[model samples]
Target: MEKKELVMNCTLALHGCRTSYDRSDLDSWYLLGTYEYDGSKLYLNTLDDKICYCDRYDATPLKSWDSLSAMLTSEIERIFGLFDADGHCIDEDVPTTPVVI
Candidate 1:
């Protein structure tokens, strides 16, 4: 649950919500958090675990849903590693300890 002071003033249209599937129940959806994406400005919102939200953020109308989704997809692609023609991830090595990139 989110703290009262960190209440999210974000809307679903402009903010992308990240969800998770419980290890025990794959069919169920649980919210992880919200991401406020404004083009180059993307930040983890202070939203609590819920599937829906109001249409306004801080008394301002949120951006289109398309913008939020597009940003989320782009960010995921950048973070997720690429795969090879053989259908395996290009980088297969596992790190035993922390190493700075």
Candidate 2:
């Protein structure tokens, strides 16, 4: 995915907040989850009815959203596989799949 594609994916994922007066409101927009790249690291925040998952990665600075999205997607898949229906980790195994944004 390119920058546009990553942006579009994030936008679509945040559709529920499109009508909100403050699109930048983390609480409203991140009801599901959010990802951020801070030059040297990637951060993930996943919120659900039963739990919230927060993680960070000390990764190389991504030059494009393509890389950023790839990392985010991969982390998300890992999170999903690690957790059970109740948001609890099922096992110690971590996911290695590269999910597209």
Candidate 3:
């Protein structure tokens, strides 16, 4: 008989297409991903020339969520962000949460 071992690497990411405000750019894709425990990340639309930019912080510890679902659910909000009633962004100094503002 022979001995064998299995190795598993769990990783997940979500992507979607969004149209740019400028008429020349048209549409582009954005990303949000990797397992929460595996250091989840958010790549959003940039303000300047770059299409996308990384929104992760070294000091913040928003990764390592309880489960895969929780990670996905929370990270999605980084795209929408904490919007106010008047459609403005609400900034909070919470490390565990995303801050698009």
Q: Go through the candidates in order and give the clash count of each.
A: 0, 0, 1
Give model 1 RMSD, 1 decimal.
16.6
Tell me model 3's lDDT, rounded to 2 decimals. 0.38
Residue 48 in candidate 3, Cα distance off native in Å: 36
Q: Give per-residue CA lDDT, model 1, range 23-84, as digits (tens).
A: 44332322323433321222322232222211213312232223435544543443233334
Candidate 3: minimum summed lDDT over ten consecutive residues — where?
A: 1-10
Q: What residue runs in model 3 are displaced by over 4 Å at the alpha carbon?
A: 1-13, 16-62, 75-81, 92-101
In candidate 1, how many Å is residue 17 off?
11
Residue by residue across 17-45, what tens digits does model 2's lDDT show? 23654435555213333343211222223
- Candidate 2 Cα errors over 4 Å, as ranges: 1-66, 92-101
The better-scoring model by lDDT among 2 and 3 is 3
* Clashing residue pairs for model 2: none
**How far does residue 66 in candidate 2 sit from its true spot (Å)?**
5.9
* Candidate with more favorable, higher TM-score: 1 or 3: 3
RMSD of each: 16.6, 13.3, 16.7
Q: Note the residue pairs that clash in candidate 1.
A: none
State the displacement of the C-alpha of residue 32, model 3, in Å, after optimal TM-score superposition. 4.1
Model 3, residue pairs in steric clash: 36-64
Best candidate, TM-score-wise?
2
Please list the residue runs of candidate 1 whose C-alpha ends up more than 4 Å from where it truly belongs after superposition. Answer: 1-71, 79-81, 94-101
